[model samples]
Target: MRGSTNRNTRRVRGVLGAAIVVCAVTTALPGAASADPAGVARTAGAEVGTGVGVERVSVAPDGTQSDGGSTGGAITTDGRRIVFSSSATNIAPGNAAGSERVYLRDEPSGQLKSVGSYPIASPVISGDGEYAAYWVLLFRDTKVKLAQWTAGSSIGLNCDALNCSQPSLSGDGRYVANVATIGRPSTSQRIDVWDWHANTKQELAWFDHTAPSRPSISGDGRFVAYQNGRTKDVFLWDRDHGSTSGPIEGAAKEATLVQISEDGSKLVYLSGTDTYVHDVSTGTAHLVPNVKGLAIDPTGNHLLYAPNDTAGPSLKLRDLTAGTDEIVSNQPASAGVDAVSAGGRDVVFQSTADDIVPGDTNGKSDVFVRRFS
Candidate 1:
């Protein structure tokens, strides 16, 4: 069965240029290989749910009727582990209750484990696949709490001020970055980081009106990138330097999503018709025209984005150092590349087009992964 691609929203802008199509990464047949550019050796796209036991799931925020299940802000660097929230019981047992539950799929082992129950959202997983952080509404307390799932147990995070949401974890799973309203009388939302392994907490930034929007921590836990809600500009917090860098000079004031590279060197964001990748060292923005939905690989070298102006739109990848652009997928403009892996090797996205994969009969959007070999 097929699913839908609906999540948080972002603004769209101008048209993209004609894509430079290299040969396909790999042949459609299994075990087939094809020549490709330097950074990406070979590439192939396949359905993520195929042969993985994911069925058509109906999900909504609070028991309303929606088309597909939620990825729950869940993706990993290895492309081998996927965590999502589904309304289907068949994904794993104990989900038979018909409520939304989080499930983790270890692709290499073909093992599916139910992380927990009780209304979860915004799940972020560690690169090593050992830890997960999500928000769960505790009915008894009548407040939202951030829950940490590691090694099959659920641990409640300290959101004592009342509400907590948008949990992001470092690649190593040692540190978690989140937004919570803390202080007596629940003063305001603040961005905080917790070292789960060390059992320590550090406050990165505080906002009086609203939480720093979409706070993202680097894989190494050295930097936190977020949009300063007050200024509507991008800011990067360096743990080692103990300094915050932004309202980034060239960044758009309306920029909503800010993604920091694994090494804490580059920040990518979309502003109007252009996508800008800012160099942390130089504070310079490398502008890519007519692009949206961008992701920077862990190395900070490769960038993947969806062009808004393609005649038949698809995903494209550009090697920053090499200055080479390769068409990631040419499926229609309606199809999008949702997430890219750490090394720019694996990309996961959703498509309503049936031709994205063979035997997609259900006519619902399905998650597909492209692997660069």
Candidate 2:
């Protein structure tokens, strides 16, 4: 999702010396969700995404970090690669001394890497975890930059004539989408899609009279979703067909664009206190029950979310087809859920619950991952 603030399954040595074995037990909570069946299997929780692979994911282990932490949003999919914007210099090597930089944690190797020396924010990493797209502050202006982290290089996606932000990338890292302000006086904002590997960019949508905000892209870059100017309606762009469609019936005017399914048939949005999945072809909407912070899998078979009740929030994995809901986290996540893998097999969230992992005594919000087979 674009508006939220924003982990991995690799076994890396020299990290979290002791690993907690998560169970594959299914716990049933009846009446918790709509169309839910009984006894849905829920995966036990394991702590991951702590940057340093520690029991608790508070600032870096260097003890110089603070509780304020980084921004909340989709930093990555699959929970294998996570990138967060932070000001902590010790979080990664060669971090810009005083600027906020984007950091990536390669869970398989247990390494913390810095993307660049510029100030960055709201980074989104591809499903493969090889690339990251984020907004970087250069000089007095901010532009969207795409980094091929594996290659140790980055290039500005948006030109100097435009100020860009709110970037979204496909699972394979081939397509990068962003919103940028173009033209004089910077009154107009346009949505653009860049073929990272091809080094080509195209404007997907440009409303000379209105500005679109918050873009969500599908795994293969087939579909793109965003708000329709200043209206409550939402729109989806089909890159393959070069066609665009509507306020997507049933979407509340105040709904925030969330995720677009890989096939471009399902659109998810949040309106008021509820989240809805609209079938673009049928123009029908399904309300996800008792959960917020929703992320739908590319297949649309599973949906991941956090308990809507903020006072005692927890992570939930729902099987849309069988109508079953399973609690991913054994304990309440005081800081709420963060991101889910594109396959819905792994979920990353933050919690104040001490029992989520063994020896979690950091006494601060820590990140955890729950995995399912």
For TM-score, the strongest prediction is 1
Per-residue lDDT, model 1, residue 57, is 20
Off by over 4 Å in 1: 1-74, 118-122, 140-150, 182-187, 250-254, 332-338, 363-365
- Among residues 3 or more apart in sequence or in different chains, the pairs in candidate 2 whose N, CA or C atoms overlap within 3 Å are 4-72, 4-73, 5-72, 5-73, 6-72, 6-73, 7-79, 36-323, 78-341, 232-253
Worst 10 residues of 1 by lDDT: 22-31
Full-model lDDT for every candidate: 0.57, 0.57
Model 2: worst 10 consecutive residues (lDDT sum) = 4-13
Q: For all the candidates, what are their Cα RMSDs to the real structure?
A: 12.8, 12.0
Candidate 2's C-alpha runs over 4 A off are 1-78, 94-99, 117-120, 183-185, 208-212, 250-254, 262-265, 280-282, 289-291, 328-338, 351-366
TM-score of each: 0.73, 0.72
Cα error, candidate 2, residue 335 (Å) = 8.6
Predicted structure 2: lDDT? 0.57
Per-residue lDDT of model 1, residues 142-189, tens digit only: 232233333465666664346676777788777777776655455567
